[model samples]
Structures are given as structure tokens and as C-alpha cells.
Target: MKALSSYLTPVRACGAWLLMTLTGGGAACAQAPQEATQDRMVAKVNGAPILVSDLKQVTDAQTQGIRYQFADDPTKLANEMAAVKLNALDTLIDCQLLADEFYKIGGVMKPEFLEQDLTQIIQMGFRGDREAFMADLAQNGLALEKFRELRERILIMNVMRARIAGTVEVTEESLQEHYEKNLRRWSGPGKVKLHTVTISKKTADARSVADSLHTKLADGGDFEEIARKSSADSHATRGGEWNWLDPTDLTGTVSEVVLATKQGEISEVIEQLDAFIIVRVDDRQEGDPKPFESVKNEVTKSLMDEVSKGRIAERMIHLRAAADIQRMGAD
Candidate 1:
């Protein structure tokens, strides 16, 4: 008999051997409920009933935007369903307890806040068409009024976050350490120094205008003077001077061509967002790790995120302990 490979060997085999150890019996002892109850009491938070219907509604709402496929194996499907129900119940209990704690600490949900949030959500869904957005919400088992109420609950959670997990501070020393450790990842592929003149489509004779500006440049005319007179960019008044920007800062095909060019080279016409841009590279900076001072703010923000996670975890622990919760169903 061949010895099993270390990688191929099972950590814990899910057969009679495993079952006997886990439950002190074999497959016969491991049996599921014959019928799934529709109105099962899953959990209770501070005397509040969390029914199967409630869990299903919350799970359905959460998964509405996600795509799911049931497992081909019946046993696997059953196991997954059990897991989902347990997770949903746990989530509901935590949410309800946290919400109660939030309410106790002078957190009040305002109707005006809900109205603003729901209006934004609906507008985002249907691109500012309120009636079409409301119709979509109705299709998803959400009434405008009910959605507003839910939005208020969400707003209250946000308030809890602000009160419990406040602003995080990151020091310069930490930023320097992070920058040194991840130097290669943060450095860009390349950099460019570009002078630009942009003209919008709304302006009359766009091509002719570009040609006229190009002729002036070719005849040794001042780029700044021409940019001030002919460019339509808001910065045109300041002689079309844009602060040195990374290629990634620009969108679309223009970025591609700009990053590829050598020093002091002019690019052909590049169109973007109903406007044409003429670019000339003043210089190029090869890919190199930026100085720590240059990216200190970015590093600070990253550190703040890590701090926020720990703060939120501690706050949640306190909130859960303080809440008066009762479970209606067995764990």
C-alpha cells in the first residue's frame, strides 16, 4: 500500500470515523428534521420575536443584488441552507441588539433623514427617474414607505459608528515604515509632464480652432498665451496650467498615449468627454518609489482604516454585553 501524500491526506475525513468522534455515533445518528417549518421562531432580541419570515425577508433583501446557484448535490444544498439560516439568525440578533443599544444612547431616527437617503438611493437606481425607481422597489418587495423606515435604521447604525468609533490618527513614523515596506507596489509604471490645451464640443468650429492654435504654436507663438485665449478648460484663465498629474489621473485612451511618450514630444488630437485635448510632454519621470513625505497622507489614511477596525470591534463587544437580549430558539 502506498503512503498518502501530505497535501492529499484529509485534515479530517467526513465519514463514520469523523461522525463517531463528533457525535459519538455513525451516519444513522446524524438526521435532519423531516419537514422545514415555515413559521419557525429563530431568535429573540430583548423580548422581540425574530421569526423565520423575518430572517427570510432580511436574507432575501441582502441577496437580492447577488447571484446564487443551488448546489447540484441534495445533501450539499441542505447543509448550505442550514448554514445560511444559522448565519442569518446570528446577524439579526447582533443587529437588533446593537440597534437597541444605539437607541438607548440618544440615537433617534429622523423622517427627514430617511427621505433624503431613500430619495438618493432611488435616484441612483433609476438615474433620477423617481416613478421608475419606485416601480423597481415595488418589484423587489420594498414599498417606498417601508424602504424609508429601513433607511432610518441604517442611518441610526451610522450614528452609532460615529459616536462609538471616532476619528483615527496616524503618525508620520508609521507612514514612513509602510512606504519603505511597500515601495514597489505604490510606484507607478511611468510618469509624464504634459502641457495641455482643451476645447469643448459646444464651442463653434472646434477643429478649425485647434488648427489655428497649432499654426500659432508652429510659428513660435507662446503656448501659455494661446492657451489663455483659446482653451475652454476652467484653468484656461490661468494659462492652461494643470499641476503635474500621474497618467492614472487621466481617463481613457489619452492616458495610454500620454504615458507612452518621450520627453518634449507632442501628441495628436485626443478626444474625451465632448472635448478635444492637445498634449505635449515636457518631461518624463521613470518608475521609482516616491519619497515617504510625498505619500504621508495616503499612508495615514491606510493606518486609520486599520485603527477603525479595532475600535469598531471593541465597541461592538461592549454594545453586545450591555444589551438585554433573549433568544427564543436554541443555538
Candidate 2:
């Protein structure tokens, strides 16, 4: 499975900053000698220099995807790039303003949390190659120290969320209403308690192995024992027992075969990827609506999620209003 960071790309938040830094002429300004560039300013956020190098990195990273989209049309590509650059600059200025406000409001990550998050990001994003990841960040024109500061700001935003959006509660009446409205979707044809054995073609002749198991089962041999000895599945060690899974949860062919069988009956050798499977329907239950009392907790959790989303949205609006936001080139 891909790591969470690999999918979410939290590092892209810093990429946003890098985009603005590059397009806002921060890179060129940074390259100029300090003595000669003393009076020159690219852009400023509450008197802090938005360096030329910072702008270049951010713009370069952010524009990479846009560049690909318009690869076939240079004129359209230039227009898109220009728009992306302006938007990126505005976004960076807003982010910096928010971070400044976040600090003012006593928003900060605990040292331990910062270290743990950084470790997780490194492990998930860089696959434990911290030095190489740092080098890549440098090549993208991001400073390790500045990126850490950005991470800290993000952590603080989360902290603000926790402080503002407290616990959510779901009422029993709302849950009952939802249950009544959506109960049809949960109903099914029936349930099956199945005993299954799988043999991979790589390990043995699938047809021969399945035939042997069928004979053993017919002779009243221990089903679990036969499964343990012959099945090539990872679950073979546990006697090929799959906890009573819903037919709907099973793959199309497996579901069709299992649903067709009667209790105490076995399936014909069913072919799957690299293997043949034998399934026995041990027990069955027809689908029925679960009593409201039985699933009240689940219903309550769903309602709470809805309430939490609304509260978070409201909180974000308030935070944005109270924040001292000044966009450098928004006009």
C-alpha cells in the first residue's frame, strides 16, 4: 500500500510557497549582492522580504503540472502559467499573513509533535532517505528550516481546529430518521458461513489438488485440517478461515459460486488469479434489517461527522476574518 503522505503530498504546501517566491521575482533579488540590493524590494509581507529565490522555487514547483497540461499549446501555456504565477503569489502572501496571525494567537506545535510529524513525513514521503529528501527540497529551492516553519504553521492550524471545534453529538432521533431513509441499501439476499481452500498453480496442479480435497471432504475428513495442509493462501496457516463475509463483499465469481451453493455443499473448482478455490457453505442466514437498538452507535457516529464538518467550516471563516491578511499583488 502507498503511504498516506505519498498520496496526500503534504510537502505540496511548501511547494505553494516556492511557487510564489519564484514568480514574484524573489530569486533574482536574492542573487543580487546585499550591499547593492539594500534598497531594492521584490515584495514584502508586513515588512518581511519575500526573497527572489523563494519566489522562483515556489513558481517552478507549482507550474510543473500546469506546464504539462499546456505542453501542446505554447500560447495557452504562457497564459495559464501567468495566471498560476499571480494566484500562487497571492496565496503565499495570504499563507504568511495567516501564519503570523496563528503565532499571535499562541498557535504552535509542541516540540515532540513536530519531531514525530517530521519523522513520519520523512519515512512516508522519502522512504527513510532523509539526506536525499533534503537535497531534493534544496533543488526545488526550499530551505529545510523554512519548510519546518511551514510545517509548524500547519500544525498550529490543526490545533486551532481542535480548540474551536469541540466534541460533536448526534441525537437518537436524527439517527432513526437516517436509518429509516437508507435501510433498503443495507438489506441483502442472504449470508453465508463458508469454508474455503485455495491452491496456487505455482505450488501444485490446481485441478489435481482440488480433486484430492473434494474426495477428502466427501470421506468426512477434517475440512480445516485439509485446508491447512493444501491451501496456498496466506490464511492457510489459520486453516483458511475467512470470518463470515457478506456475499456483496466477495469478488464477482466467488460471490456467484458461494451464493449458488447450499449449506454443507462444496463448490466445483473455481479458477481465480493463479489458483483454484474450493468453497463450502457451512451455514446461511437470510438478510433482514437490524434492530435500531443494535446499530444506534453507528448511526450516532455518522451524524456527529456531519455536525463536525459544519462546525469546522464556520470556524475557518472566523479565523480568516480575524487574521491580518495583506496580499502582495492581489490588486
Candidate 3:
């Protein structure tokens, strides 16, 4: 019976489980009712009553899957479920308002696209098996027509969001600002591609063997072949290739030795408890921010995302302000 605030963002459509007090305490509200059951009103957007059945579909879609996570805490689990249902209810109300505005503003979608989308969903989600998809609906007690209605509404909401996003443009200044602030993301820490050959301490004169391997590597001998024949390390089979590794992941003497080595150069013999290691730096990269012009397109797209989210949120706020939304259970 709680009246939801218009400022709330739309409930995310994923996840599942619930506690909202409503009619038919246990039996009638035990599970989402089948489509044939009489529609019970729970809210009204304008004069169109949002039915309890509609709330149930949203609730079930968002709740039932996560029920087992809170198996040990019944009271907390119920509260969590109620919160999810409440969120879904609010989102339903907002969706109705947005759908009205969308159609009123001449938003149009082709019928064929809807069918194509439904087909894709069934194919991708149910291995192209229509009956399996239908069985899922039957298990949830949902009718196909009703399910289609929800999908259509979701499609309409997407159209509305797209319209708002279309009006958003990323400015040059915004892109530069974003790039400067998130430089760490674009410019990663220094990394190295390395290959190693090792001789275990258990071997006779391990240092001498390590030196011999290092000389072969320095003389353009195949590092992989040398590692496969003589190295005692776990990764010897792969020619001791560690691929690209962050310098931070290397510890103590290993870190010091690798960081000081130049690309295409071999490190001096490093003595460890288990083996004598000789590493070759196949390649290295410095942690420097990429030039602005080099990453301009990517930065622009990221800025557009930020702009679009802001625009959609603002649009929703304006839409809610001009609409009438009523929850049936509010005293």
C-alpha cells in the first residue's frame, strides 16, 4: 500500500523473490495468478488501473530466483522480497506513464520487429524451442498475450530512452575532461611479456646450468626449446611463457630483476629457494596516457553514455511530475 516516489529510478528487470502486504494473504497471493484469474487492482496511472496480476508478473520476474540466498533468515528474506516487489511496482507505474507519453509523442514501432524480437528471445533463450518457452510461461502462470504486452511496453520504454539519448551530444571539452580524470583506465601500469628457463637446486651446479641457458637465449637460441629440454619449472612445457604480466605481481628479487631489464634483453641468473631462474623480457610497455587524438572516438562514446544516462533521468523526472500515479493500498 506504499505510494512510490516519482523520483525513483525504474526497477532493474533482472534477479528474483518478496514481502508486500496485499489481499488474499497466503493462498490467493501465494504465487503469481494465472492469466485467467480475475484482475485485482493495485494502482492506477491516469484512469488505467494497474492490476495485482501485473504486479505479480513483475514481482516474480524480479524475485523468485534469489529466494534461496536468504534461506536461513526468513524475516530478513521477506523484507528483502518486499523491497524488490515495491521497486517493481514503482517501475510499473513509471513505465505506464512513459508508455503513454511515448505513444502521444508519435512513437511508432513496426509489428514485424516485435515478432522478430520474440523469435530471437525464444531461439536464444530456449534453444529455438517454442514449446519450452511456452512451458516456462505456464510454470509462471503467465499467458502469452500478457507476456507480449509486457515485452511491448519494455520496447516502448526503450524507444523513449532512445529518444532522450538522441538529443544528447558529447562536447569536446567533456571528452577531454573524462579522459584526463580516468587516465589510469586508458593508460595501464607498466607490463612485460616474459619467458623463463630454470634449473632446480637439486640439479648439479644449478647456477652453471642457468648461466648456460642465459647464454643460449642471448645468442638467439630458441627460449621455448631450451626451456622444454632443461627447465625444471612448472611452466617449462609452455616454454616458460608468462604472457603479459603486471610488474606488481612479481615480488622481491624477481620484481627488481625484471623491472631493471630492457625489452628483448635477458636477465642475470636469479637465485631462488627452489630454482635458479633466468628471464627474458620479450616485450615491455610503459604506463603513459595515450594521446588524446588517438583515443578520441572511444572517449567521445564514453561521454555520450554519461550524457544519455543524465538525459533519461531528467526526462523521467519531468514525465513523473506531469502524471497522476496512485497506489491502491495507501491509507
Candidate 4:
């Protein structure tokens, strides 16, 4: 794994496992076992066989989620499970394809690298309990060496991604285009810009004071001026001004008052356990569209991911086209 060390960073969790799934290697296991044997070849990629048992290992967790989601409706679970098995097989096939490519290029994974990763997996994934880790592998019908092989294949795919991502750069035009095309995703939640005036209820005449302040505010008094002289909230120094905030951030009845208040209008005194508060709605924004300049860095990263995924998807298509991919049973 000298090349692996050179190209790939330390592998954590793989979050891009399905970057090349559309290339094929799918079969519907929602029906029946392809054969009475558990080792039936569900797919063959470049003359290499991927077994049904291997497919099941990949589908196990996914099906677990689906099973829980549709527990009350067995029919829906079965229907979704059929597609899950198919997609899981595709993902496995893609992994195998990448592994095959790695070896074809004379890439070799070192045994020491495998041992290091296995040690780390034991430490991180199983709290250094090697016995528990071994038990888990055994229960899953995975031998120690086979599990390492799986990990090594994953490392190879990650290295491939690292290489691809490194080679690709985000262009300014592409970044802007991606952001504009996906405006809804880039848009922000509804938010309000607000200022407040607070009167401490601890004062014996707090309600009377709050009422007089509200009357003054209603008689064209400047809310900020009145707040600066009389308010008790944390923002009093800045005339009770607050940064643009999500309405939900206000919490409970406070949010309700803020939402119902019209922009530039002073709200009625809102009574609280320890304070009497009045809010002025400076501004309100719905589905706020953030400027591109404000979110350029985030958009750039998203664009790069899209670019990397596109390239990997293209690679998968080419690999499938050049290889002998046989889908066993119904796909």
C-alpha cells in the first residue's frame, strides 16, 4: 500500500460509497434464493465472481433501516427490500470493479497496512476488544483475512477518489452556476431582524412603566431611544438591537409575538416570568436568498463534490462498458 499511503489520506468513515453504483451488478433478492446454496454468484465483474453472501453483507444494514421504517407494513418493506438488495449488489459490484482496476494498474496493498487498519478498527470500532471484534466478524460469516481484503478494497476506492478530487478544480463559472441552479438549497430559512425594549418585572411598578413606554412608542417615540433609556435586556447598550435571527431562536410565545408583529411596528408589552418585553420588528425575510459572495466558499466545496461525483460516475460507466458484467437471476 505504498501508493495508498502516497495518494490517500488516513481513511475514516467512507461517506461516498455509492459514487459509482449506476454501472450495474443488480439482482432482485426480494423473491427467492438464486440457488439453495448461499454462495451463488450474484454478479461477475471482469471474470471475478461476487457471491450472494457478499451481497447480503452489504444489504444487511440498509435492510435493517427499511425494516424498521416499514415494520407496520410488511408489503412495503418487501417491495423496498427488493430494490435495496439490487442497489446493494450494484454497490458491491462497483467496489469490486475499483478493486480490480487497482490491481490491474500494478497497485499492491501491503500486509502491514492491513494490520495497522485492523488494529485501528479494533481500537476505534470495538473499544480495543479484539475478542468482540473477532466475534462480530465470525457472526457475520466474514473471516479475518477476508475482512481485511474488504477494507483494502475500500482504501483503494478512497485513494481513487482522492486522486480524482485532487485533479479536479472548481472554476468560478461553475461555482456560480451551481449555486444559481440550486438556489432553493442555498437559500436560508425565514429570519427576522429585531430590536427589543425590556422592563424588569422585579420593579414594583414594572407593568406601569412598560405601559407608559408602550404608550410613548405608540405616540411616534423612537423605539431605540426609549429602549436605550429604559430597557433591561442584554442588547440595551446597542439600543436593544439584535442581529438577524431565525424566528424559532426567540422560543415559545416570544417567537409568536415577533412573527405576528409587522415590520417597523412596535409590539405590545409581552409579559414574562421575570421581565416585561416589547419588540420592534425592524425587518422580516422569508426564504431569504443569501448572496453568492456570502456563501462562495460553501458553494465551491459543493461544486467540487459534484464534479468529483460526475467524474467517478463516468469512470464507472467506462469500466462497466469494458468489462464482462453478468447479472445473475432477476435484476
- For all predictions, the C-alpha RMSD in Å is 20.6, 16.2, 16.6, 14.8
Residue-wise C-alpha lDDT for candidate 2, range 1-331, written one tens digit per residue:
1222221122212321111111211111112224324533446655555545445545666566555655654434666689867765554554454455455554444456666677767776778888867776675555666556545544444444444456775566788897787674345656778888887878656678777888888778888998898888777877777777788787646787787788888777776656778888888887887787787776676667666657866755665576544434332
Per the 3 Å backbone cut-off, how many clashing residue pairs does candidate 3 have? Answer: 7
Better of 2 and 3 by TM-score: 3
Candidate 1's C-alpha runs over 4 A off are 1-40, 68-87, 177-297, 327-331
Question: lDDT per residue, candidate 4, 82-103, as tens digits?
Answer: 8876567777677777777766
Which segments of model 4 are wrong by more than 4 Å? 1-38, 61-83, 189-286
Per-residue C-alpha lDDT of model 1 across residues 151-246, encoded as one tens digit per residue: 443444445555556766666677677678778656776666667788787889876777677767756678778788888877788776667678
Candidate 3, residues 1-331, lDDT tens digits: the string is: 1111111223322111111122322221112235535676777787666787777766775465445555544434566688876677777776787777765654554457667667766766677888888887776666776766676666566656766667656678888999998886577558899988889989998778888888888898998999899988887999888878897787556776787788888887777656778888888887898888998988887777778878878988888788787788621
Which model is ahead, 1 or 2, in terms of lDDT?
A: 2
* Model 2 accuracy (lDDT, Cα): 0.60
TM-score per model over all chains:
0.47, 0.41, 0.51, 0.54
Highest lDDT scorer: 4
lDDT of each: 0.58, 0.60, 0.68, 0.69
Model 1 backbone overlap count: 0
Q: Where in model 2 is the C-alpha error above 4 Å?
A: 1-105, 110-113, 178-302
Among these predictions, the greatest TM-score belongs to 4
| Shift of residue 299 alpha carbon in model 3, Å | 4.1
The clash number for model 4 is 1
